[model samples]
Target: MTYSGDVTSGGAPAVRELDRLTITKVSVGPMDNNAYLLRCRDTGEQVLIDAANEAPRLVELVGDGGLAAVVTTHRHMDHWVALEEVVVKTGARPLVHADDADGLPIDAETLTDGDTVAVGGCSLEVIHLKGHTPGSIALLYRDPAGTPHLFTGDSLFPGGVGNTDQDPERFGQLIDDVEHKLFDRLPDETWFYPGHGKDSTLGAERPSVPQWRARGW
Candidate 1:
């Protein structure tokens, strides 16, 4: 089936295929966190975006091919509830931003703003969008044959930026980084997957940048 990017908690995943990689998005946990399973066609190597919840299910999704790493987008507990179990089951490396590493249940490979995380031969550019958390990061995978795909963990969503606890400074920082690092650099056609709920393209959310800024959400 074609990739729709719409998934429900406990429902089926939405799969999108590119020339070199395949992305499978599944919604898990009570918060309805979205975990992405990326497979490299050339190497059969896989990496999971977040082990949010349902360890058994996530391990099942991983299967015997083994997981290279489990990337926790931020320090949010809702995003890494199953990280320990999933890692125990698959021995996948844990990767997270430096600021949020202490919040995780286990030690993680600290990532900097411009660090690159690879899934087989595919390289994911890490964009650090601070404010929602001190260590929030998004993964950018530019398809060789098509537009870019972004996995934004609670940073840039369909409607607005991530929650900043109603703090004006935090909100300002997040919006600015998101606009500069993401909107300003990436094209409108870039397809983005959020930490929760459905997916959308930069084109679909670009016009609302001013409104999101004005409202400070």
Candidate 2:
């Protein structure tokens, strides 16, 4: 599905409202990493994904409601360059999978597969997918009146799965998790937001699973 929204000033990115959730996608840092702000319309409770960079802009997005949590998809420097600043400014706790919690800039709460994070009345289910990193994860939100939305940190993307280790075993694991845990289960209309670049849907990417597997990357 196409998302049309107003872009913010100073490279703040555009805001897309899906049902009760308002998502703002911003590209930041030298790597051009994507940071997303998810807000619950009814309660104004918000959750940030990545906190990749540009602390000032992120703080501006956080505003007065502050953030309920900042979820780090994996233990990657590019994804958390502004984590400390954003967390400090918003007083929002940082969360990461237990396997990747250590070595983060600050203390973080642990999230396991199937764990649900509540943002006001919205619920985001966590799905841990191994490969790109031992603890990479994706969050799924099913809108009551609309299609389900998925926030895949660095796991699944539009063109293909996230880059993985050269090792065949690691690549296999990632593909397995994605195919079984994601593609096989979720509906075709599910909207997937990746860690970087444009968004896509399961319907759009489903046909390429075989191609992705054969390519082995």
Candidate 3:
């Protein structure tokens, strides 16, 4: 599916298409993290990308059953602080990779790469990126409009890329995943919504891959 939109200051206004599914971004927290609410216009099925620090807005969006579940890109507090509230409000489970699943403020359904989640007539495929954290996974799916979307938590950014200085082996592993797994496998034009910063397409980010790799981050 082709998803197109006019570029804007906060990335592009989420593209609305004939398909019932729409992604509304709720910019939350001190760093202005992007929390996405994936909704099915027709069925009212929704999935929350990150709870971040905005419980009020997040809770308001969870009123519809379209908010099927919460999918966290990583275990960071900023990304998950409101998870419990959203879960309580929507009665939806929180999905996360098994590795970073521990010490979560709330218990969640442990997930791994390749798991498929269906909500509001949309199904998302899970991809294990494993760079930002051992269990870091990216969600991949094509909206009804046929636009390919990747919800990359803190893994890949517009120009800066994910921080790997936390752990040497982990950081090195993340670098490898970006070069071989994410950049190579996914379509170059795939739209990427990272944990922070403006959104960018895989094709748009390809030119910087070399620079990212050269940094040995």
Candidate whose TM-score is highest: 1
| Stretches of model 3 off by over 4 angstroms after superposition | 1-15
Error of 2 at 75 (Å): 0.6
lDDT of prediction 3: 0.76
The TM-score of predicted model 2 comes to 0.94
lDDT of 3 at 196: 69
After superposition, the stretches of candidate 2 with alpha carbons farther than 4 Å from their true spots are 1-12
Query: Which predicted model would earn the best lDDT?
Result: 1
lDDT by residue (44-88, candidate 2, tens digit) is 999999988888888987888879999999998889989999988
TM-score of each: 0.99, 0.94, 0.88
Per-residue CA lDDT of model 3 for 79-198, tens digit only, reads 888889878877888998999899579888988888988767778887777867778878887765556888888988888558877666777788787777678887876888888666
Candidate 1 accuracy as lDDT: 0.94
How far residue 158's Cα lies from its native spot in candidate 1, in Å, is 0.6
Residue 154 in candidate 1 has what lDDT?
A: 97
> Comparing candidate 1 with candidate 3, which one achieves the higher TM-score?
1
Report every candidate's CA lDDT: 0.94, 0.88, 0.76
